[model samples]
Target: MGSCENQEFECKKQKPLLIEGPIIVGAGPSGLAVAACLKNNGVPSVILERNDCLASLWQQRAYDRLKLHLPKQFCELPLFGFPENFPKYPTKHQFISYVESYANHFSIKPIFNQVVEKAEFFQSIGLWRVKTQDFEYFSRWLIVATGENAEPMRPEIAGIEKFDGTVVHTSRYKSGSDFGNQRVLVVGCGNSGMEVSLDLCRHNASPYMVVRNTVHVLPREVFGFSTFGIAMALLKWVPLRLVDKFLLLAANFTLGNTDRLGLKRPKTGPIELKNATGKTPVLDVGALSQIRSGKIKVMNGVREITKSGAKFIDGQEKEFDSIILATGYKSNVPVWLKGSDFFTEDGLPKTPFPNSWKGEKGLYTVGFTRRGLLGTASDSLKIARDIADQWRTIKDTKNICNSQIALQM
Candidate 1:
């Protein structure tokens, strides 16, 4: 234990780990966006991720055929545009690569495998205590960027326990080749359900889509331009109602007799549906064509799971070899937080639906409330600006206290 020999011993010993500045949980696009925004504003942040890599949800969970519903321009992160050679609608693999590149470009090195178990705010210290399984981290600001898609929500289907067929969530579904030639019932007529049904049809599987309500399915590209792009442009110049009417005309002109083809247009317009309920209409890629071609069939909502198959609300029963639930996801924030004041009983933020980013008690969330990449980008910028403003006040107060102490001495 000589002093010179002790140097090697000290080098091997574990040192106390600490992180200052802001602590961002979850390294998905939302988290990455917040971290990038903070860095650009001269504030540093440490990202803690439960998974092995950044953007694990996109890299691991998305289907092979997934593409951005919105155009690339609207989906890219703030200040970092998509690659020049990429298409208008980037594929799932391309989007994953873009996320990876975005993190690398921003020099965001997230601490992997540290799943945040609890977050507590201490008023005495004016800091947030974030505890993982193995360590404790304290931060002046806690940004929970673990967006809405972190947890998959499965609806309770009656008699599903007795069904002998394969059942899986859309998150676990990769390709349809593995489910070849099987009759697949895709529950829910959202984008994922529509796309999965189409995938199953292409792979020789008999695909049946459950459209429970009037669905607003718009063509992905109309008149050689993205319908989303056109809608966004129209939104700037016109009211939402007028924009929706224009979109309805465009849909009727492009898709042609969607009502006759089993797709009855919703009573409400697409923009209204999205704004009122955050549930946007599905942007039809090729599912509509497949449905019109008789390659894909439509069914009503599931009434019960019979021994033979599922019974729809219309008393129609059909046997399927497999059931795929594309029911969507819930945010994981309310689980990690201790109290119920911040969130509702359904785990949604009590504070408006989409403005959960403006959190209280030193807790902020980025992507939990919003719907798309553009929403994530917008949330991240606002959160960063708010955090920066608060930090400036803290610094100013500290400086004033120090000056008074020096004068007294």
Candidate 2:
């Protein structure tokens, strides 16, 4: 190992099979943020990423018109602000640029393309054995920043495979230019579905949106202020039901009631505005206008896909050239930590303290709960602080133990 400021950097010496210190899985925004913090604190850690680039979601899954639902000022990583020229709401490219900048700023050298196959904790040794495709790393702690959007979840309707048309998930959808002049069906009523549908309309594609349930859609901006500001204000003072009523009234007055199209106005609270954490209601950015203007047609959820088209649960059949499944994503945590009795009954990590993971010692998960768009970043900051405190406590305890041993000798 190499000495740095009189302390040995564990990973400096390349053993036949052992690498050291904390191991971070995933190189997304959360992973990068954690790495940056660790580096700043002089903590020796290794980040294992499955992709060659950081923020693979931004580089791959994001659509062209996608903008940060949260303002850039709040969306930035800790200690790093967005560029001066960046828009208040940055585009996908701008977000990726910011992530790259963060990595460069921190000098974080993550092992690119190193997919973690599995991880097992050696309780006796107090080390986690993380196996990748090419190498195995032993670390005292593991941070599963794999993120919630690890895998895309596509709806499995009957006869979808037989359609013989272009079937792609929103994750694979880059732009709507290719669907030009074609009849398109956007499955799901999430933000991605609405955004893609709007893009399709702009691209001259006749787009139809499949809404399975009534979604509470709010404007990105309200009363010259960000919708998130309004949400934050309301969440503090107003009751959830009252907030829902106010939002519903606003939607009806502005976007019109989608109930006539077989979708009901949700009686729930206002759409949580933060960012696209896959849980917050999709903001209705011109989708309602497009629908009302006859640019896009709203349809019920798909019952089954047919050879020619699809059959909706409402008994309506329509033919389309392409189907964009915006069904959402699945958290594949078991792939790495299978048989671990730490996850919730629903397979999510069990967090006794709300958003903080509790079952595993020296292990933590961030960005798992979809509190909203800013939820990941917010949770990341909290988790990072908590981990730092824990690390400091351990170091202090070790120092005390060493001093006591020396005194005894």
Candidate 3:
């Protein structure tokens, strides 16, 4: 047996499983917020995290130019605000600091380095049997706070594996200083790709942006205010179609067509609105100006990776020193839970709440969807409150049952 398995076996023989009120499976912003809410409602919960510290993804995966896409006012946790001196759009470090403060304020002591491997609902016992590498714990409720960014989505392009060059995903990306003199190819046109491309250009790296599809790029700030604030205001007063039209007009006026890059304008709208909420602002950060100035080159999607360079679908071949994949991530739920077929076909949890799940009985999930702005934190609070209420009802019913039995005796 493995070391962890042997340890678990030894522990099980000496000590039985400890039944906690609820076991939260992550210690991210969502999990920490949920734990705080449960504590407020007098419900005890144990948060288990795979990382050694809270907000590891924020501290590690993000690039240096990363800042809160949402304004600080909206991104703050429940009962907490960004430091008064911090900018309206806090940097990555500032955001991580705020998360640290939130955890400290709530006195949330999550078990770090404890990865929850499996969680199965025992119908007969009416408890969730959670297993990790260290030990097993039984809880009446299970909250799967595993966020959507669990699995990094790396595309399988032809000859990618044989490229014989450096390949890194957004998760592995750290800074732009390392790409000083190399010809870098950044794949994907999302925020990360856009931001990284701009930063690399400023650092004197010959960066080429590979756009597979069209995207709506917006300014980080609008009329001296955050773009998100402006979008929210417009969304409240205007219809979605009108908003789309206005945005399209603005984008066309500001960015024009993709013809400059030897590509055609997409028939569909530039932006993707998955939720009913306002638009998620896309920061320009001088990317367009750089492209216009020839500082950074824009190319079509990659058809294949040649031995010495990459081949575009347009029959053009360009040599590159490195390729950075800004591809997205996938949800990685535990394996022991065999009933995950109920989740979205893409492996994402299906919650009663638009982005939140209607966890079975005592079970709940927080921060599964990439809702706009502070949506994850907001969803976490609601789920925590619901779980607290359910726990109370369950306790009350159990007490009443015991009382009836005692009277019969």
Cα displacement (angstroms), candidate 3, residue 131, comes to: 1.0
- Can you rank all candidates by lDDT, best first? 1, 2, 3
Structure candidate 2, residue pairs in collision? 275-373
Whole-model lDDT values for every prediction = 0.82, 0.74, 0.73
Candidate 3 lDDT trough over 10 residues, lowest sum: 1-10
lDDT of 1 by residue, 1-409 (tens): 1111000122222232345568888999999999999888877788889998878888878889998888899898987989999998899899989999998898888878778888888789776877777567777778878877888989999998888889999989999997999998889888999999999988999998888778898888788988988999998999999999989999889888788876788889998888676777888888888998888998878999876679999888899899999899888777787743776656566676457677677788787555688888988898888888877887899999999999999
User: How does model 2 score by TM-score?
Assistant: 0.88
Per-residue lDDT of 199 in model 2? 96
Using lDDT as the measure, the top candidate is: 1
Whichever of 1 and 3 has more TM-score, that candidate is 1
- Highest TM-score among the candidates is held by which one? 1
Cand. 1 TM to true fold? 0.91
lDDT of 2 by residue, 186-237 (tens): 8887788888989999899999888887676777776666766676678699
